[model samples]
Target chain A: MSIADNIETESDIGLSRTGKQREFAGSLAMPHDYFVLLKPRVMSLVVFTAFVGLIMAPGNIHPFIALVAISAIAVGAGAAGALNMWYDADIDAIMSRTSNRPIPAGIVAPVSALTFGIFMAFMSVMILGVLVNWLSASLLAFTIFFYVIVYSHWLKRSTPQNIVIGGAAGAFPPVIGWVAVTNSIGIESIILFAIIFVWTPPHFWSLALFRSDDYKKAGIPMMPIVAGNRSTQNQIFGYSIALAIVGVLPWVLGFGGITYAMVSVVFGMAFVYFAFGVLRMSPSDDEMKPAKKLFVFSIIYLFALFATLLGEALWTILL
Target chain B: MDNIVIKVTRVEDERIELNDKQKKARRARNIAIALLLGLLVVVFYFVTVLKFGPVVLERTL
Candidate 1:
């Protein structure tokens, strides 16, 4: 039987037919379901960071090879996303924030998701290995394994530090992209990874601030759910400060140009301001406006930082 | 916020009928898979049997 078979109409639990249909509609969205599995918003960030990494590396890579490498990394990232959704299907079903996901919606079966993830992981790594350098391929493989086994299977739900440690999986894309071009790890890639690693907690904590109830209901140990809102906010502030400091490292390291430095400093200041907002807001404040604002701005901040890096690198090379 | 709760009562087994769009998607997916498998076979042939190797020596020095 498919995973969808386990999903019952509300009538099985004795609800009215229309009510059951409504619930089914909410849970079992089909057709365009695979797109949802990709976590497209997350994919966008991964793709951008990986692109920057590829462009900023010292050596010249063939355009076609770079294209293939980036595509492989994107597939690998998507595979990780699919595996995460598969493993979290049960919790996803219970959380209002995630109940509309493909698996929980009964649009895709759990086993199917598992198969798709494994297939994509192998295809991605293999393609990278054959067409790109082995170093990049190995890194991509490790990233997939870390995301699926270490983070999804083990760390998440087991600890509130899940985002902190699991963030490594997301941070590796740029490094992998860098290695794809230069065939070697560099200080620049390490600095990029560090910025993302520190940036994750504040980004996710802001999300948790607003979605704590969903996490509480799902029995997940997100920071805001495990600790109080105040503690989570404090953690967000600390991580934001760390992220800002790290964001400036690429500029100071001579890997970035003056434009990048100026943009990074400005974005870092904005990040700190948002972080302070999270810290100062009352827990009883309706809608968790500060947390939501910080979450939105955090995304733009990362994109701007990477974009600025790319711009500066191009400028330096051309001028 | 008043949360609305809805339910589904399966008329038959918990099987959902795939709509026309889903059918088209399945067909497209099958074609893509077949093409990929074919490409893999050709790549394997070129790499292992034909030994169509990289011209690194020509490029290096």
Candidate 2:
């Protein structure tokens, strides 16, 4: 059954027939439901990248300031996730993969999510501006706006290249972190941004290939939905190649040390190999195992790459 | 359909009203969250004050 029909049936099981009553029922959401709105997993990655940026910058910030900056960035990322969930509730309700989300599951009222998200967004940006640097604050503001307005509202349903352009919003954290420390943007920060921006297409497309049905049901113009599986696979392979190069650029450019270089080369090759596997798989393969493998490996690849960078930075400081 | 609707509404109302124990636990949790949020605000304020020193305090005055 369609998601709307499912929600209707589900809500009717324990609530009144009218929409208003269903909303009222949802208003009694628990604290955990509110936490789910923050998208904790995504916030962790944002916090890590921003921390790396802060540490890797030329100078040091006071520990308290660094903590505050990172916290603000984390809150900002969570705010964006909440806003995305708020705006995409309709599509989210339809998609099997997203059907259990707080809004669609009748755990939280949509209006509450919207108001909470807006309030958090304003709070984070103001804290970053007043307590930290305005440059980072402005970047954080733009990131939230771009993610909510440009990507979620405009590009998601309208274009297959939604992720390609929208990826910039995620890529801004490290740059914001760098600005938080130095009050300026540098080549190193831009390279960090480039790594993530280039990494996004391949990373997200792999999942899209595996879950194309979800996007189709949700009417989202994901790469695999608009373009055929073959086209998506080919594009994944192409972006993987670009990501491999960009992933290694830090080591090659002398910013990263031997440890990072080794890690990058190994993981970059593995990424390409996974993408190649996806490309070679037959379209009729029901499991889409290769795409799933690539999707899982992509997450590991990003974490390992950043962890290596952080380790190298710490190593330099200690030695 | 009418009977089902009535039954569902009753269940929803019961779900919304927490038992005494659940209410106590929820209240405690809310208090903890409020304290944590307050601590964060205090830290931010002090850090701002430390960074800007007398300038911030003077501006407030």
Candidate 3:
């Protein structure tokens, strides 16, 4: 059965009560529910990328300052996630993938989540500005604003290009990290941003291919839902090519070393291969194995690419 | 205004209190969160002032 039908069935079983009823039915939600609102997995990726940026940027930062900067970025990312959850609760309730989210599941009141998110956002930005440099703090604030206001509220429901444009929010972490250290953005930091920005479309589109029905049901304008599978697949392939080139650009420009170059070349090829596999698959293939494979590999590709850069930076520092 | 206020208070008291225990739990959670946030602020303070010391202080001042 479709996810829509599943949601209907779940709702029929008393899960569709008003938010107030659900909120009052249970005692306070566990701490983990609050954590879920932060979207920890996504936050982890933000933290890792930001850390890499901090490490690779020219100059040394006191370890404590670095820790504070990374912490502020993480909290800011989490705050954005919370705000996204709060705003998207209505659609999130209907989507099977998001049905269990804190607000939608009624574990946390929407107001509480909103307050928490806004509070964290303000606190994190202030801390970063006061402790680290104002440059990094401003970037973090902009990242949060872009994700919560521009992407979540505006673009997500309106356009198939949502992820493409909204991807900038995620791209800023590395730039923030770089700026935290160098107190300015450089060519290398811009390259880091470009890598994630180009990589996001193909990575997200592959997931959308398999879960197009979720977007359709939720009235979200994901690429596969708005533009048919073939077009999305082609776009994914095109973006993957761009991603591969941009992913290796740091090494090519001599910002990164041979180790980064090797990892980028291998993973870049792997990413393109997966996208090609998705491209070649017919729409009638219900399993969507190729798309699923591409989605999973895209994550690994990013992690490996960034980890290579981090490793290279550490090597340079230690040796 | 006096009569209206009296009636509102009476109505508010008569309203069913569903899940009084749950309300308590929610209050507890909020308190916990407040404490955690306060701790985080303290940590941020220590990291900024104690760890970075005069360099950070000089910049801020």
Candidate 4:
């Protein structure tokens, strides 16, 4: 039977329905299904960081071109997210945290999600290449491939270091944005890339700290699943220290100003302090309150640093 | 005489009637696709204009 046979109303996506529906009636897929398929939250982060990268570059680009570049990157990121959801649908259905995702929730069928993902990925890359620089286009293409093929299909199931490596795919956006502006890659942009790359492990590990059961049940080899809580806690602390130092680099390297430096340093210290809390918390603590606190603050820390850079860039442009 | 039964393809077997919600969902998706296509055209036009600049208008016919 088609997945639609299984879909009860919107409110009740009944558990009675099979979790992973490989084949389904395409017409049953809703607009909201496709929207969530894009993983809007992740897309927003990609778009925001990319916009900052484009804005901070030492060159001028017409506003229209800039918009196209950022839109393409956003679409590309969305396409990758869709592919990830498609592949992970099986595991996602088992995990409470991911159970509501489009594929797992049966809002969208796996084949439909895959088709939409591939089509969007092709369009985003081709359009970006035709209208913008090929360098940026290639990076966009690579990011999608890396996220889908390397991370989702392979490392995610095979290794505990999945997020650590998969994190690189997310890190590419700022560099792609910078390249879109300058038509070249530079160290300054690499530092921007470093901020996201180093920030990902701890941020995800903190979430995994609390959601370890979910990952364990899903059979995904997340760090906390393979490594004991104490080890994962230690690693989170180490990455936090690294993120704090790297977070301040833009200011030290002269790309960021005093405002950027101040924001990064303050948030960076706070991030490390939160990680230390995670590190010191008793492993058996059922609440995982320290890990949860770190998880929430890590998001704020990244946003504060990037927001400061974005604000500085806008200020320079205006004044 | 016993008659042979035919098997349908998986997708055909999976065909579902579009309930009101499903129909509405499909309609919404169609509208979104149309809008995005229009946006794409606008983006391409603007990008071309920006890239070619005054040279396009200045070119000899």
Candidate 5:
């Protein structure tokens, strides 16, 4: 339900601009504010992962269909993000990191955002189902449902493992992309899903370490707030080990070539090293450098792993 | 559009006119929506053509 799905992009969705307005007389909301509701940064990652999954799947697809598929997937993710902002407006206002989000900033009304989210969600899923395959569309729908219902609405406040579970919503893009191409699931796409899924807890827990105050203020049960910093650090370390193992699975399973193997092992080690840094943090340090480092590096780590996979696949295809 | 535009009806009523900021914001949003709609039209056309080929337009009434 949150990862910032809790990583970044507290960016939320907006009115079609033609819709009814009330928050401000004449509705001062800019189109950009509406666009922010879509969570563009998060959408970028979803698009990239889904694009890679589509490309890596074992089939040829019409380029237009693939384009539509990716667009739909991205829009669907955005729709979910909009719903998240709509649902989390109260807490969002409390958290400094998210307070300026369009809804909280009074740039967009919550009902308008809700309307925009529902409309886009319906449109994206229907377009994908019609232009692409039902399987992918179903996956997209489920991703939105899981994020909006399971994560944002339910788990986000109820449990420390909110992201551990909600991360599935983020991980589904690639699988949806792969299914958009194959019209079926495959272990390769599953591996891509696994990488993101396993990568999420540590990625977010690092953020939770520093932003615990925000969560505390908002009453969101992020790992650090719920489980305590020490337990969260240990869990991050444990997940780091799991992440390293899972990161290398593509290579182990042989879909990834030597280049991917190298990227995975190197970045994977760096990930663990960072996590271990967080694990070894001292109370004397005024700032949580290790957690911050791990947080920043984790974004790079996931991107590098996925990029290598995308690059290797493209290389294989082009050559 | 001004934030508060006075529309002279038979009764001389005033319609809401956006301020400078709202006018610019509305213009920007309209342009964005127009662009997205234009893109959607193009995408749907291509998808129809690609999916159905030359036969896309061959349907009977």
Candidate 6:
């Protein structure tokens, strides 16, 4: 059977399992399958960062329009993610970590995934353009294309610097968020972009270290695969330091206050500690405790950074 | 020798079947996406160029 048929069967069963009465009552109503295409965890981060950027900007955007713009950006990010999954389905099937994704699990066809992504991408850019501004719309369009074309198709297979170069696409959401509000880039948004760009390497490399075998099996030359663990660890350390410095840029540039500075300093120290653990630990430890620590810490690092920005914004407004 | 030949023939047949289905699915999906993209373009053009459309921030001031 085709993957589409499998998905239909699964959905039917899922609905039936709930109760026959409910299933009979709403037999024609299909669950929104496009939700799976969104990669919700990644979308959440994109939304949060964009929200922070929007709030931190100097100008005022109508609340409803701001919400729409953020939602559009999130949808666009998810669209890029779905398209990426469609293109990389072959390699994804080989990697254990991604082997059970909707495409490979027979829950969504690759073609369906591609269609969903393309639809969302165009809709998002158009919505943001109409409801928000052309600057934001154009940035959103370029970000989607950059991720799909430049990063995924061109850089991923050919270069070790894939994450480093492609990281810029991920970094653009905050700047896009800023533009959505003010319709222009500024020091604050650029600093936020820098923070994410510098943070991407260490965050991703940690996962690459622990999942080295999976990456190798997929024939993807990750940092640990190509450059070896020690070099990857050293690179992680260097990026961590740069990330820490960038984390403090908003405060230093006088766009933020003491609270953001203090929170950033503490966040940076925690990140450096985790990176140092990765650098100091032995490769043969097998459990990959340090790399795992860094991976978990990385998420907290971003959350804390943005949360602090929101906190500062609130404090300034209230007091 | 006969068994090996039969197994190889079956595999080839399965591969060909999968390829045909994949192609059909691809065409259907592409057409759907193209329609949606065209709709999006029309919406954007109307919003930007229509005189009675919503005010754009860039145009004001």
> DockQ values for all predictions?
0.11, 0.13, 0.19, 0.31, 0.18, 0.03
lDDT of each prediction vs. the true structure? 0.84, 0.87, 0.89, 0.89, 0.90, 0.82
Query: Across residues A153-266, which tens digit of lDDT does each residue of candidate 6 receive?
Result: 998887778888899888999999999989998988999999999999999999999999998898877888899998999999999999999999999999878888998999
Give the per-residue lDDT digits (tens) of candidate 4, residues A1-319.
5544544333223323333442443356767779889999999999999999999999998888899999999999999999999998999999998999988876777888998999999999999899999999999999999999999998999998999999999999999999999999999889999999999999999999999999999998888779889999999999999999999999999989999988998898899899989999998889999999999998888888998999999999999
Candidate 2 TM-score, true structure as reference: 0.85
Docking level of model 5: incorrect
| Candidate No. with top lDDT | 5
Q: Clashing pairs in model 6? A: none
C-alpha TM-score for every candidate: 0.81, 0.85, 0.86, 0.88, 0.88, 0.77
Model 6: residues with Cα > 4 Å off, grouped in runs: A1-33, B1-61
What local lDDT does model 2 show for residue A235?
95
In the range A50-77, model 2's lDDT, one tens digit per residue, is 9988888888788889999999999999
Off by over 4 Å in 1: A1-32, B1-25, B35-61
The window of 10 residues in a row where model 1 chain A has the poorest summed lDDT is: A22-31
What DockQ does model 2 achieve? 0.13
- The Cα error of candidate 4 at residue B32, in Å, is 1.5
Cα RMSD for candidates in order: 11.0, 8.9, 9.6, 7.7, 11.4, 11.6
lDDT of 5 by residue, A26-142 (tens): 677887888899999999999999999998999899987998999999999999999999999999999999999999998888988999899999999999999999999999999
* Chain A TM-score values for every predicted structure, listed in order: 0.89, 0.92, 0.92, 0.92, 0.92, 0.89
Better of 1 and 3 by TM-score: 3
